[model samples]
Target: MELTDNDRSIATFTMLAHAVVHWFELAIPIFLVVWLDAFEVSVAVVGVVVALGYVPFGLGALPAGLLADRYGPKRLVVLCLAGTSVSFVTLAVATSIYAVAASLLCWGILASIYHPAGLALISTGVEDRGTVFAWHGIAGNVGIALGPFATATLLLVLEWRLVAVALAVPGLLATLYGLRLQFDPTAGLEGDSESDTNADGDTGSRAGSAFVSNSRTLFASSFLLVFAVVTFVGLYYRGVLTYLPELLGGLPAMEGIEPPAGLEELSLGDYVYVGLLVAGMAGQYAAGKLTSRVAVARGLVAVFVGLAILAVAFVPVSAMGLAAIVLYCVVLGFSLFAIEPFYQEAVAVYTPPESRGLSYGYTYLGMFGLGSLSIAFGGVLLDRATVGVFFGTLSILALIGAGLSVRLLTGPSPTDTEVPEPTAADD
Candidate 1:
């Protein structure tokens, strides 16, 4: 693969956009504690509220993907970011749990477009897909780390409403800048620039047939297997991350947790939560590179098994004192996201270039859609059962994902047709 101006531009734009997507997505967890107190709701009820937003974040991807295929990624991406910013502004003014739910609903619907639009843009547009995916994952991890850090930091000074408004700022600016970026969405396809759907002039009455046909094409192959893996990944992801910050904040940690002389709201647990996400940058980069070198299923199997162990071990490890907790956080954080690049690569391998957007649609539908239920499930657990039960459940999920990944070992080796090699420029 060769690099071009378009690759650089698209890669840069999508990477930044990916980070912003996660910036908002992950920060919501940080707000959970505050919402629980402010709204005076039970954990189970709050979980349902958050899920209302999250479910659509996944479910909307089907239509968003179709729209991406119909219009183009850039326009939908613009709407996603811009609309999310507006939704967050609404959140800032929210007076009740109902208002917050409405705000999240808007955010979910708008932010939902990103995975399909952005991932499809990169898969079909960037020549060196793996390299860009590495960068993309790294950027998203940064957002995951920073969004919470920013939220926590701001909460120390401003009210939660103000923090919401402040966090919305960068996304709006990113939308403005991304709106001006120009790149060829099909530059990575080399000579085969036109997609089959576009070539056939798919529209209106044919949309239903296109969806059924596209979905069939995906499920007919190993894409179904890839989808299953991602679904499990989503389950673990939402289950753990949704409450991690608040969970960590409650941990009895060492000297680092105490606020400095002037700072009031700072704590070591916040650092631990953020650090775990920061560690994921390394995992994401490594796994993204690994995709070019190894079979994705084998890697996913190893990663999922590791996650199961970590899930079972997390509560015990935190008991050993602050250092052990931090170490656990680092490893847990790294393991949390390591599966992403591989599964992303898997999706690309099992699917075609033409339905790329729809493939990612199903991809996120499994991830965000069904995965949102775990929030409620976890909430119920936290409300009724011990933390031990919660971790044990997470362990089961990881093992199931591992079991699914084991089947992919029978697939053929990589080729130019499967995982695309990283370009020299990427290195």
Candidate 2:
């Protein structure tokens, strides 16, 4: 399906924003290797430092969603990109762990804007929402995979500091480019007549009342179960990526590989880590296609179960041979991202279109904010325990997510069906 000019404009802007967000995000793990040595910190210490950034990145989404409503998705998207650029530049210059932590926190706060703003914009603006969602997820996974690969590649020639500054360039360019593009943010929803947004015109008290009301209404429905699924998936997504390269480094396949001349901070694990996420791009596309065709809850259960089985096999697979390990990485990456579209659509199925911004805001709030613990927790495990324990925990976590999906599938029909649509007078 071809997107019209307006849809293309909006979709392209959101896609760019999504990609840049993950670009800075996943790159941190690659830098974790450098930080571990340069700052002389333990895995737990460094993990906490990075979580300082990610926690806000997730936690701030609710406010970011509100701000996106008061202002606009386009404006917030620009701030997210530009602020993230500055934050990375800050990270590049940091001389202490404290400075690094502060930079990450700043980045998180700004990057937090992307999900609520971007997804809301898409649900409202794009004519072909499902296709755009697929493309958006694929673009994000590209940034996800490329971040580490780009950082690792640049580090081969330049210092990590230079690489950081270099990474900031594309985002800045993207922000500027985003500024000049314009489209009606609600083009797709123009005919719907019923929605929970007065957002741009919302007064302080009215907005708060709406927030409380919406929260009450959403939670009273199946959205709560949807939220639970993401919280668990969030753990799998953040925990695994946070320490994956280091975990891969311990494998026999990653042994005996040396960095190029004068490059002591590089690791062979980074490339394999990137390859796994690159595989996720395919998963993202596939899941996007599946979201509209399948029972979202049922499909998600299968994906999470795949994640559980893969997590259990991760350590054992590395012991088999390089070919087996490579195959495992592909399947694992595929399963990891495959859950995204299914759950994203699940958010829609369980909530109203009016509170789109707030719904997605809370969605990310659970996924990223609460999910940041996985990073800290994984760091602690890697620092204090064995690889088997870490992967075993992730397997258990994925099973928990699978259970949540099962509940969602068998629970009452979508709660969105129960809500009465608000008219203009309700606004």
Candidate 3:
């Protein structure tokens, strides 16, 4: 099906908004490090603050989902964009560590408003859900790619506080653009003739008949295994995303690279670390195309296996170690992001369309919320263990996660699709 002009416009706008949000996500880690050093605080404390941003995304997913379902996703997206803009700006001005903490807490909560609502909007707006979602993921990955670069650039030219100010501008512009969006309620919810349900998982019927069936379908065993694998995937992905820079600094390769000007001398590579993230963007886009040609499960399994091999390639003492680090970063980017579409497909397979929103909310909670807790734990582990132990531990978990993907292929359920699964999967 061809997209109408309005559909194209909405999708373009949605992608733009999503890219802006990812910028803030990429900025926080590097910023946290700078803040810690500037304030003479411990790395452990900075880790806590960095991890804190993730809390609201998970905790607020349900509410964000509910708001999308009830009031329409458009408003929620606007609110989140505005909230992020305000929060990022406040972060620029924040002097006290407590103030930065509070701002991030708010940022995390507001950032939560975007994903479910933005995604739901995209799903509703486009006829081709898989490709649209893939593109959406690409946009986010691109934002993530640019964010650290932007931060690094600012750090090069100005004080860290000024860098924060520079970062806030894109978010503010995105928020303003978001507020002007025109939403067509009828067009977006076209296929959703099912009864409305809130985010809390409460059941209600439309006129006591049309919407109130409460028998939630239990997935076949394969779905459970798929879910479990995804959980570990989430943990590994979030953990690595949280710690890559510190890992670099801890390594021998970066011991010689000069720090960004005015920044304290550090062992971490001084180049645009954003390049590492951009490589992942390339991986995600490639994976998105590849998943459709092969089975999603098979594609994910290949990526995960690659992750394990990349982990084994790690050696804390040689130049080969640096090559392994770059390789694994790209591999993680490929596998971590490439698996998302398959996960979305699994949700569609396991749950009824009417209940899909709630199912997705729970799935994200597992992936982002509970997964975030796992990330926090990894930070704790990093505090106690060496960088080698950290990657080694994550590699083991990823291999285990890949093994679980086999379960997804074991049952009849995975091969069956009630909705038209993507034909020409990458197209």
Which tens-of-lDDT digit does each residue in 180-220 have in candidate 3? 66645234445553434333222232222222221123233
Please name the candidate that would achieve the greatest lDDT relative to the true structure: 2
User: What are the lDDT scores of the predictions, listed in order?
Assistant: 0.81, 0.82, 0.65
Q: For residues 1-427, write the lDDT of model 1, one tens digit per residue.
A: 4457888898788887888888898788788999999989999888888887877888999888877876777788888989998898899788899999999999999989999889888877777777778789899878877887788789888989999999999899989988888777776666542344342212221366667766765676777788899999999999998877778877776444566676566666766777887888888877877887888888999999999999999788878998898889899888888889888878766676767778888898989888867888999998899888998999999999999898766654323223212223222
Candidate 1 backbone clash number? 1
Root-mean-square deviation (CA) per prediction? 6.1, 3.9, 6.7
Evaluated at residue 245, the lDDT of candidate 1 is 73
| Deviation of model 3 at 171, angstroms | 2.3
> Which residue pairs collide in model 1, if any?
257-268
User: Ten consecutive residues with minimal summed lDDT in candidate 2?
Assistant: 197-206
